[model samples]
Target: MRQRLTPVPADLTGTVVTPGDRRYAGLRSTYTTRGTPEAVLLPRTTAEVAAALGYAREQGRPVAVRSGGHGLSGSSTNDGGLVIDLSALNRVEVLDRATRLVRVEAGARWAQVAAALAPYGLAISSGDHGNVGVGGLATGGGVGWLVRSYGLTVDHVRAVKVVLADGTVVRADADREPELFWAVRGAGAGVGIVVAFEIEATEVRNVGVAQIAVAARPDGSTLRRWAEVLRESPRELSTAAMLLPYGSSTVLSITAVVAAESLRRVRPLVAPLREIGDLLDDRVDLVPYPALVPTAHLHPNVGQQPNLTTNGLLAGMDGGDAAAIMRAARGRHRALVQLRSVGGAVNDVPPEETAYPHRHQETLVVASVFPPHGPGALDAAWRGLADRVDGAYVNFESRADARTFGRAYPGPTGERVAAAWRRYDPDGLFRAPGRLPDLTASRG
Candidate 1:
């Protein structure tokens, strides 16, 4: 039930939007969908966020937090609850030019960060989608154009400013609040609201964009060979294979980015992929490191399209797995299958070092169908390749399977994340949608 809107806090610096408010509709909308949130509080400061959390607790209303509102699971919006919109907190500051230390507010998008850092010839490894929120992506393992070169976004995180469930603000990092720091890196949705991220940006001038189009079918051998080629490729080269649906046929399109200073140096590394199938188009060009992320590809304006997605982390794809994936693609009238190459710098970090435990996985596979087609076929296809599936990336994840969550943060990492949840958010105010209860919350 929607709660009655109380008088706005006079001392609150940000805007409190409720039902019937002029901006309510716009504020309640996220990337994938919209929600009927009772109240949307746009907080400009950490203190305002804490106040809003306290207000939500006082009103006995569920709380949801939104940065760029790109969460695939729609965790940023809740029905008849308080949505703490952090869009006003967008700010990016370069702390150190020498070390490339930068402080980015949680609400700041990757495009804003890229634009801010480009003048300095500095860039943080982030998702290819420029409009993707810095907070959500960084927290849930960012696999971007530079995955092979710099590693996941969490790898470069120096620190984080988090607002606890009890409205307490704390700074977490390797030394300060180390446990919380570890949890915030990956299993971030369940814990608390992150206010800012202190990232160690890397220096890069230019990157090479590699694109190859091949007319393909569900032969299984084609995709298997593509995976093999990527596995042996140089660290500078990172690639993603997309199964694009055209009428009744599906085309296998491979796109790669070489995070090298020049295209001449990366040609040998990415040359073998051209012979994978009947090549239709091949283009390799040099551009600014930030320019590599195409705005059109992000699909920021996903209006009414019902996007059903499933993701899995794969160690290696055999012919059987590839065949299953192809069959799944062919079965669906429209299936968006994306397999991102993630091994070099991403796997370098040990699973135990952070909450993101799938370090040994070679590729991140995400399959989606818009407008809600045969949804069962998607899951069935994923199940066929279940043996090679170790874990799932939280950013691309929409399912709430206990086994999948267990795989995502396995062993001690799971235990530690639960511990952090209990320690900071005992009330379970920020529990992810369809997720199990936090340890302490369950006990209570």
Candidate 2:
């Protein structure tokens, strides 16, 4: 028998979509998991968001909050529950061109945000993919194309407008509601529904981009040289590398983004990278900053990409650590491994200033497994790398287990994050499943 959903509230009469509704098909799932929610509430304003939250609470169902529905863990959608979809509330406006302070709605994709700010010669350092939601990336750590120069997207957040579990709307910043503001920067999933963010944009009209592919040796010497070039290079250059199977061996494919506007300056910075190994391919171009994350990447999420992903932070990739990464990519399971240069402007921020405290790490390593493989396969491929990694990033992780949370938060950061979550949301309404155990007891 089909479950009967409660009648939609008068305020949400036109906004609610049920199973039989034609719109329900598009709103039913995330990027990684398919969901069958009883109803999906599409709110266009902050007041409507508050109403939607109240309606979900009255239904007595597990509630999931979705911004752009691109979350890797699939926590944005639930099997049989209510989903507060915020895609309609997307709006980007420049409050002050002098200060480069821009207000962005949570529902907006990074592509839309970049397009909106292009006219004003302003841009936020969002993720590489244009389809990623602004809320998810900004709240968590944003390791983007200009990350080494401008830092994480969360680092530029000036304030946030959030709707709490009790349907109370509040604005948090450095001077007001400081604790809530701090928690929202990195560990926001457990606190409340953030409707919008006020972020400081950078002045960037054009950037130099280089796409290079080189032959990678099995012993990890090539990998070490790649890291060495990034560490010694100026803060203006940031790169993302992927280890891929090339014929009988693996090749390292890299996309290097330099913050300079002219090719004259970009060539010298990336010259060292080409000399690392036998170059398979190399290309450089000076394109508009918006081109890096173009609107062409935008698409609806209907569980199109299904993969299990995990990541770790490295203070520095030594020969042993580098070999472990290569081995994981070439192992029996053949997990896909990717690396991002971190530790430029990212490390300039003190660890205690925000919820994201992995400030000392120099590189971000991510590994993923697709179909025909499960958690065991992923674990087996990652076993050799488990000890070498110093920390983990919450956004890339597919599991919401206690162990994953510990690695993401670690030591005093975890304790403080737990206390803040409890203070703001005592009933645990927004907590991810199995994410918040008894941390004090676990530590003991």
Candidate 3:
């Protein structure tokens, strides 16, 4: 039987929530709100985490960890297990401005971090939105506009403070626990809970950002242009063009962002598309990085939707392949497709090093159903469509099996990662959608 602490620990400083707790429902729900846990433990300090883990280990109870609650796969949330909620550990210290490095608590959200760092004229290469937690996103192989110039967020991670499964606390950095550090940089959360992250900050200020909407070209001409432009364009700019369906007509919503002072400087580069033919609603302008994340979630009322796409170096989108790929997604099923350019600093690192595999692929063609996720669903359509996908981005990942995760990383890195995970989490306490193989066992 599980050890029941009816009255809770008197010495415990942080909040301990049970089924009767008023905040239990709110604490249990994530952004996706799919997974549910038995009880929630909000530990204010790393010491509290260690204590809780020690208790669970003694009781032989399973435990899961959560930071941002933005996990798409419900990996952090649980149905009937103990959860170490680190959402309270939101502390960011500007350790060294000269070194351009910042230490952020695992619970720190990018939104707060960005605003906090803006005053110092320094920021980390974070994902698109400020709401996403720095730890969860980085561990899953972060890919944002900054990715084009600086590489994944993991690449910038200098060190991490984590509590292992067996109540052991350790620090992983380039100098300490080098192998564990490498594994944590990309797959840290897989083995344990990270309380804090030490990452190199980028000196970023205001820049030119654009959101252009256009009439979708069904014949594949629009895709061809996007592929050619992104492949040949200079590394200074990063662009992602999306094709969404509205009624019978398709709308191409393109977001072209760059680190330039004014949009005019890059107008000539995008002029080719304007010359190609007619488009609708081109609202390309400069805006703050924080404003880019439109506050919204895709509608999920309907059944499962169709989403088929790919991500690779721009070279992978050959003329014929690009045309066929785009054409496959343009239909009544409403598979919104996006072609993302990858070159800049993202290509600086080889795929073999990190769990994030696609370092060289130039463009990521992602397509999925429009609204809702069910019976008579669009799952089959998307499954069949995306079956041809050559790459799997852990960040964009839905619920994929082990084989699907194998393709998440490059060559031998996948097996090596499995090995690391199995060693730490021998029993796979947190089993969910995005869980990889027993990394430790694989390594063994």
Q: How many pairs collide in each candidate, listed in order? A: 0, 0, 27
Most lDDT-accurate candidate:
2
Candidate 2 Cα errors over 4 Å, as ranges:
1-3, 432-444
Model 2 TM-score on a 0 to 1 scale: 0.97
What order do candidates take by lDDT, descending?
Answer: 2, 1, 3
Ranking by TM-score: 2, 1, 3
What TM-scores do the predictions have?
0.94, 0.97, 0.87
lDDT per residue, candidate 1, 285-356, as tens digits? Answer: 888876865443443323344476778887898877788778767763445778899989988898888898
Per-residue lDDT of 227 in model 3: 64
Find the candidate with the highest TM-score and give its number: 2
Clashes of 1: 0
Query: lDDT of model 3 at residue 173?
Result: 85
lDDT of 2 by residue, 1-444 (tens): 545677877887789988999989999999888888888999999999999989888877788999888888888898788899999989999999999999999999999999999999999998999999988888888999999999989899999999998999999999999999999999887778899999999999999999999999999999999999999999999999999998779999999999998999999999999999999999999998889889998888899988899999999979999999999999988899999999999999998888999999989999999988888989988998999999898888998777888999988888888887787777777764633443433443
Q: Where is model 3 more than 4 Å wrong at Cα?
A: 1-13, 58-62, 264-266, 269-277, 293-315, 323-328, 370-379, 383-387, 430-436, 439-444
lDDT of each: 0.79, 0.90, 0.65
